[model samples]
Target: MLTTTTSKINIQVRRFTIFDIENLYTYLTHLSPETKKRFGPHKFDKQSIFDFYRESDKNIGYITLDNENHSIIGYFIIKRGFLAHDRERLEGYRLTLDNQTDCTFAPSLADHWQGSGVGKLVFQFILSDLKKMKFSRIILWGGVQSDNTRAVNYYINLGFKTLGQFSHNGNNLDMIYSIDQSTGKTDGGFDQ
Candidate 1:
């Protein structure tokens, strides 16, 4: 369990479970259109979320909950390997990624908590968890949209290196973050 002083909210991250269905539903459904437009890895409806929970092993889900209100404030997923599209796009950089040492990451925070520093806190927890799980790097699941300056800056600040750009549902930037165990520092810079 971890706490966020910046957000002024007592929160803890844990594996998502079946019990979280109702709260998770509320969280997903309530996302503003703008938020939804930026985060569309899958359907955000109740049935889709339920289906995701049922197939949790395919991609591990984590939820950050507010201790006081017990509502989910953040959600993330870690897939053990890269998606086919991601792999193909990354190959354009002439860098082959190893499935054993690399994984894919996707993260989303509640609308109200979007710029509250809570995302950074939760991300730190995620990095630690990934290291423990033996993953040495992470590729953004469905590259970030180029126009989302806030998210792009967050990734760059966290040391995610931009590999290239590709047009998907929109203009997207492919990025990768190598986990450095020695100093927990990343090779920071933008490739584009």
Candidate 2:
């Protein structure tokens, strides 16, 4: 469990539970349209999320308020030793370690809690947890629309470098960012 003192937010990062499915679904539904279009089309219904909790619950991680509020702010799926099939793009980017240790998908705080540094705090918590898990490397990928300069700049400022850019489904061009474990830094350059 990692807590950020600066925000007065106590975050406990732990395995998912059957009880968390509904909250996860609610949170996903409340995501901004732009955020949904970028990282989503999630395949989780109540039953599916519950089943996933039973199956890979050991590896899946979630961060929630430590108080009675029990609010789920963010969640991430981490694989201790290999990238799942869904993480193939991350693998193609050559960002995984021989021991794997990669974060498949991580979504920030729900819309209401965004822009309050909750996302950065959660990310830092994940990084600290990864180090304790003996992971030598960690990486995440995000697709940014050319027009969304804010999203691109956010990733760059967070230490991600553009690996390349490609068009998907015809007109949507997406840029890939990669961070090396050794340096934990990015080049901060755009391909175009």
Predicted model with the maximum TM-score: 1
**Most lDDT-accurate candidate:** 1
Q: Quote model 1's TM-score.
A: 0.88
Name the Cα RMSD for model 1: 5.2
Query: What is the C-alpha lDDT profile of model 2 across 30-127, one tens digit per residue?
Result: 77886666554235466666665566634555655645467676665654444444355544556544545444334555656656666665655555
Every model: Cα RMSD to truth: 5.2, 7.0
What lDDT does the true structure give each of the candidates? Answer: 0.79, 0.53
What C-alpha lDDT does candidate 1 achieve relative to the native structure?
0.79
Using Cα atoms with residue i matched to residue i, what is each candidate's TM-score against the true structure?
A: 0.88, 0.66
Candidate 1 Cα misplacement greater than 4 A, ranges: 183-192
Superposed model 2: Cα runs more than 4 Å off: 8-15, 57-59, 66-68, 80-99, 141-151, 169-192
